[model samples]
Target: MAFEVFKKSSAPVSTVPSVTIQKRGLISLNRAAYELIGSPEAVELLWDSDRRVVGLRATDLANPDAYPARPQSAQSNRGPILVAGSLFTRYIGLDTTEAKRWVPQVEDGILTLDLKVEGQPVSSNRRGTGESARETK
Candidate 1:
């Protein structure tokens, strides 16, 4: 009888774009999502109450409605993109009791998340010790 050796995989991480709305209202974007928008430093949030959709449009930092879209930390260049959205969520009356993840669609340079579409619930245990949504600058 011949025994086979166990091997570890070195496959690359998933590049499928996704966005998460944290329990505290922070918006987290996966690497693919970040790159989909050309990696902007700021974004303007647009809400469509009628359609129950949230949109993210890249904009200059000087824009009054611009929100900072920065990497999780300086140490990891490939880390998730974080955006503080506590106020925006509250304004839109979105329930943030649990984190939710959804696939985004881009149209005319705007990334949109349709709340009407069911979102995957994110386990709290998987969340990192990053900035909270309440800490928006």
Candidate 2:
């Protein structure tokens, strides 16, 4: 029997829209999600307590309540859209001790993050080891 080597594909990354709420209250929107929201410079964070869903709506940068959607890095505008959302997270009573990734759905010109949906825990970068940082509880 001949041994075959495993090969990795060089295909482009997924286009499915995804959003992540980091442990430090940073909201990150992948390229697909950013484009789905019209790639605005700012967005308004909305909350529905009854449904426990968070909504994001595009708005002008001048809007006082608007959160600026900045590039993940200064060198790349094509990267994820990052928003400082500490106040918003605290207001919504979300547990920020751990990071979570969720797939968002868009409706009526708004992007929504349903808390009811089970989110995948994002691994922490702080650990030098490559192990997942899942909650002990």
Most TM-score-accurate candidate: 2
Residue-by-residue lDDT tens digits, candidate 2, 91-116: 99999888788889998999999999
Q: What is the lDDT of residue 5 in candidate 1?
A: 37
Write candidate 1's Cα lDDT for 19-125 as tens digits: 88988799999889987888999999999999999999999999999999999888988878999999999999989998788889998899999999977776543
Per-candidate clashes, comma-separated: 0, 0
Whole-model lDDT per candidate: 0.83, 0.83
Task: Spell out the clash pairs found in candidate 2.
Answer: none
For model 2, what is the C-alpha lDDT against the true structure?
0.83
